[model samples]
Target chain A: MTLEIQNASARAGGREIVHNLDLALAAGEIVAVVGPNGAGKSTLLKLACGLMPLHGGEIRFDGSKIGSLSAGELSRRRALLPQECPMRARFTALELVLMGTAISGQGRPMAERVAIAQDTLDRVGLSSFMERDIMTLSGGERQRVHLARVLAQLEAAARNGAPGCLLLDEPLSAQDMARQRLILQIAKMHAAHGGSVLLVLHDLNWAAACADRIVVMHQGRIQSHGLPRDILTSELLHDVFGIPDGCIHQHCSTGRPFVVPHDLVMPEDINKRETPCILQ
Target chain B: MRAMRVHAGWILLSLLPLLILVMLVAVEVGASGAGIGTLLHAPDVATRNLAWMVIAHIRAPRVVLAAMAGAALGAAGATMQGLFRNPLADPGLIGVSSGAALAASCVIVLGVDMAQSGFLNGWAVPLAGMLGSFLVTLLLYVFATRAGITSVTTVLLAGVAFGAFSGALTGILIFRANDTALRDLTFWTLGSFSGANWERIGLLSPFLVLAGVIATRLAVPLNAMLLGEADAALMGYPVERTKRLAMLGVAASVGPVVAFVGAIGFVGVVVPHLVRLVTGPDHRLVLPGSALLGAILLTAADTIARLVAAPAELPVGIITAALGTPVFVWLLSRIHGADIPS
Candidate 1:
């Protein structure tokens, strides 16, 4: 029950973004794609979700080309949270979550969908804020609303025991420290519950801890792919991220390989600019 | 709830006086400002013939035509606001009305006499205007949006560009016109319910009703759309299709009204907003309320237009602006710097 990408390529305005990338994620597994800025992390997620047309190769979910799926079918299988979706409406947390299923064309009665959305909000620890407007919420709370929406899609998909795929593009990037770890734990719980996840995260330490496999990307190409401990090595980090050796240390707590940078370096030092960090 | 009932009561009480005044003024202006109604009902050959000519051929059709045109413009404005997800989106503000005006002016100046059977005259200009509006709006939508999603900023910027261009072209056409052509074009641009007739009323009615119904059907999707395209698309909506449909619906509704009325402004922009303030932003309630409020507001304005000049009869558009501008300023001043959502 794994999703596979075979030599998949995508280009925007004739400029290649994701180049000949191949990936496979087993059901109930979490894969994190870490890359330097302009390494096309978001583009890869866009390609996977069929938001952008693939220039070459294929993406298959359960051995079928994802391109052939109807928009509704594709949405039912996987949900994508774009890097910056600024919704204008001042809906409650529950309504925002309901919109996720709405994309899949749930077309259920408003009351039932509202109930499901409220339940999802409660599960995501936003029960008390069910009636509060999303615009009034903090960035962390909004991210949780986003997560709850995606998780709601999965929970609804659980009837046939088919785990939904959550494709999050830098879900925790805009979030603070405490919310970041909380989101990672929630993602881990989704995977543990037999759901699939493919995340684009800059924080390698969090990915190393939570992800089942780590795929390192450099210049739109895969640099390494393996378990976190095997792939997130000092030499690979220096080569891909331009981090000097021994600067970022891997610390294990709760039996996860967590890494952190001991030194401060501007992301521009890597010479790629589009990748966003929470600091600014 | 009591407030709504009061608003409704005010509308109803005000509506009766408006209807009577519209009927009286339309009769007085269309013919000589005389006691034509009493004279026509006088049971004499010339009197009865004149009454039939004035009432059947003129005033009744004009009042109904004004009502239909007003309703259509108001509804279209509501739809455009829903389309932009911006409360300030008025049909006239974006130049859909100007595009329609230009088409209508051309038809009038060129004198495309479609009244061969005498039954289709009122409809001919409106049809031309709707076609022109459809063309211009379609072009704007195509040029503004590169992909499936339309960036709001891009749409607005493009609208301003197109609107200015269309207005310039309309000015050029008017400038080049002869005396009679200029006079005809002037009233059309200033907005008139003066050219009201059975044919015009009939032509606008179906389009208005259909556009209103289609907009209501889209209310749920439109509300979801304000959350953003990605969010709307995820919510089982055909986001791109919905946007296109709503834009087309706005043009379809607004185009004919503008063609006939000559750029009636403000009602579309103001009525929905006022409704939103009372009912919150739910389109389900907003669409219907905007339509009703628009009809009532326009009828009142036209009645005032007749009363203000009494004998001369200034255009309804003038009255609407005179009354609505202060309200617009008040609404604007009331906003305590809420962040403008992009």
Candidate 2:
């Protein structure tokens, strides 16, 4: 499936949050979106997933306009994981995950849907937590359960012969380091299975390590989009993210550029130093 | 540690016998001294006939009506809670009971002589109550929904405002009411199954059935909705349609029950929580389990109401609130640190 966003502009509370943004995701590809806070990263993801309406332009999934497809039809082709899901009801982990398959598993048997939910939970290393109440789980654990839910949605869609897209926003924010790697690995596996993943991420190093291409955003517009090696430069970081020039370095083994903000001037020291400071 | 939750199907299956037992107990324990033994083995045929008449016509209908109203409230409560994604959301949260009460008060104070007007005798108040509830629901939808999407927060706040407005109107009608009208309004507000009969049951059945079907179909979508609206939509459930169906279901079911039996509280708010404690949060279980458990609780409460004052019956609503408060507080204490959102 090819998910395309063509010159899309999204507004929130009558003000434009995403302006004339253009991007696309093909099957078997993983694209990571990196941007500073308030850069419209989450809004862009919401627009792509049809959760937010575009002020102008349009979004299409598999050559069909998003507005043309019914919600059920669109969901069969894509799933979204928001930044945070605040659940007030006490649902078991398996029950919450099973909800993900509700739409795509309409004609499928109950056993198959349950199996898919279980499989996704197991993939996220939550096999033992299937019956645990989500309220009792820690924040990171709850986040993984939701991640499993998102994966289960796509897994059911794939089983129906329509491998779809995943639009995740800050999926790793609540996770620990190992689980973060585990989540990115799961995304990679989804891409390997001919599904596409477009995830908004804050950690530049992980973005560089996992993404096939990196898209940078600043002030609701795409600043740059290219291979990780070409995109992760000190000049781009200094311009867009206000990082110091020496912070971007190529990893010795993978040759991927990783950011080391350690020796950089802190915000308070920016005016005292000769380093160009673009942050205002 | 969490208590072991019974499987939803088993809980549903087990509730059938329990409900029957509660209904039988409710039927047997009333103000009348006639028991099952009196119906079967009275000393004379005349006495047996009297026993049978009282049991079948009076106790049976009242018990069955109580069960029906309880089941409607329970299922509606579950649906409302699921739709709002708030554990505290009650069926009455959407102004159904208040609106119905306002309309019923209007009918009573106006002294509509429907018996002479060729209308269905004694049907005006209930029909007006139903209309009032539907109108409030419609107004809420118009005010809270923009385009196709309904904001849950807006719906919640607007429902409270509408409920207060209706309550104020009802108070005005109460002020203008005569002695008889005031007494009738008082009984209606406190709620009772004293008016239950075959005809009232027939009138309430269709609305309850319609609401039940809608609530049953909403189980999966409601489960998806616990993840929140955007996520529910992404999961392929029609979020907007689900919200509309839920509001309609609650209004259709709860309206008639309040119209027929006055305004019973606590059953709608507490029964679902009780069901969730035993069956977890899956609506497939919570909905049906709620219907059964609610029937049992309300039937038992009505029996208590009947027996408490012997010949003079207490309104069942008083019993529900009196009994429901302790149980609800105990439940809160039990799940306090674990489940309640901060």
Candidate 3:
């Protein structure tokens, strides 16, 4: 396994946030973690990346313990993209992307770093934003810019023969449909190029479509884990997510699973008592 | 968008000649009618010799002191703003100046002439000022952060409280000071460069130069920090180390200037923001650009302070604060109205 989490647990604010989660990833594969809100998807990613302290068990990267590696060494092998990055300074997209070379420690010259940043931006479909200020970019564009930065970091790490793992927490939440597809294609390309990806995705359809395997989480525990085609069945959806009936369907041409959620009406009794604030 | 359009490196290079020209003009504008032309070639040997004496002994040290102090404050201001990711994060605004001033005032009020006496081996005043600023900064760090995330509003408010508290203590010291010490205290609080002898300059240059170099080298990490501390750490930066460097740089840079020059205002508050508006917010540009502009701004302000009242001069701090307050107000309104990050 290029990345391994063995019986790990994480706590925040004196509450067990992620309990007894074990997952492993090999090179050249994409794994999507799908779950409802507050299911500890983000917490798991944080714990795995060592951003948060693990309360129990252990995590290893390339057979070395995560606790044993320094932040620089760990960053060289893996990169994480949080859901949102707050930017106050007016760094251009190029300068911001070039910051990915920070941990990799200046082996390449300035020109090479710039070129890699530009190439990564182009791959993420932000070719024209290289000189534009990051603050001027839209929400979706900024997300793609950070995506470019992560890809550039992983690419540089791969050159050193280090394990390359990308951990993204809700990276596509702010992206549009087309940009979401582009981001997925980029993730798949990374996996195809011998990198491992573990991304938290809220949309089950996208997760089912792009992930080689899916791990469904509920209330800080893994509910199910298997091939998407087998695990994303109507019964599993009903049992895990409480979505009943023919809400899930297989595409006629590609045989990929998708969700429609046609019967999403609130129950009459539940609406009177619990739905005081309806989501508009 | 148009405000930050200039290329910072080109702008800095272009401003260098102008800064030198301004400094040359400033050195000649004084009570003594010794101009640079007179210093170079005068009609008589005696006149030329007097001009050389004026240039070498008095004007040169004063100009050098202004430039060095300005550069230190400017770069320190830029570092603070970048570290906090707030446009209003100036060393003066964040209790550094008042803290240092209070420490110096205590030393003076107690009649401890450490520069002459063997109390701290002639290093008591500057060392005390530096220690005071460091402690206040540590207090600020503790008060303004919750769960490793910094709250800019909390920091600003805490700074205001700390400044007020320090001001009250300084007022008590002033009330207790003797007449001779009172005269010194009054001038020091208002700020001046009259103490800019070669010896003081020699004592202060190493600290200023060290701080400037460290701040300039921190450009890359400060840029990362602008993306927020958590994001900077995720990008493989040692965020704690960067924060420590920034805080220490602020103390080392501000303490000596405050100690020697007596709490010059507005330059630290204004220079970095103006430089940012001109250079965009990239620290690679902001840090160096601020240093250059700061040197220019202070030298000009000091020159005005010298010449505006003939033989009697205005305090340079009053000049800077007079010039800086309106611009600061404009900046406040612009940031508030536009919801720009402060």
Cα RMSD, each candidate: 6.7, 4.1, 5.2
lDDT of 1 by residue, B276-318 (tens): 6655555666676676667667766775676576667788878
- Off-target runs (Cα >4 Å) in candidate 2 are A160-162, A262-280, B1-8, B112-120, B337-342
What's candidate 1's DockQ score?
Answer: 0.24
Report the C-alpha lDDT of model 3 over A1-280, residue by residue, as the tens digit: 2889999998888889889999999888899999888989998898888888889999998899998988778777788999888776667888788898767645777777788889999999999888888878998899889988988877766664644899999989898899899999998888888789999998999999999999999989988898888888888778777888687778777787888885665677555664463221
Better of 1 and 2 by TM-score: 2
TM-score, structure 3 vs. true: 0.90
Q: Sort the candidates on TM-score, descending order.
A: 2, 3, 1
Q: What is the C-alpha DockQ of each candidate?
A: 0.24, 0.52, 0.41
Grade the docking of candidate 1: acceptable
Candidate 1: which pairs clash?
Answer: A102-B234, A102-B235, A102-B236, A103-B234, A103-B235, A103-B236, A105-B236
Better of 2 and 3 by lDDT: 2
By DockQ rank, best first, the candidates go 2, 3, 1
The candidate with the higher DockQ, 1 or 2, is 2
Candidate with the greatest TM-score versus the true structure: 2
Across residues B4-111, which tens digit of lDDT does each residue of candidate 2 receive?
555557767888999998899877776779989899889899999989999999999999999999999999988888887776888878888888888888898885
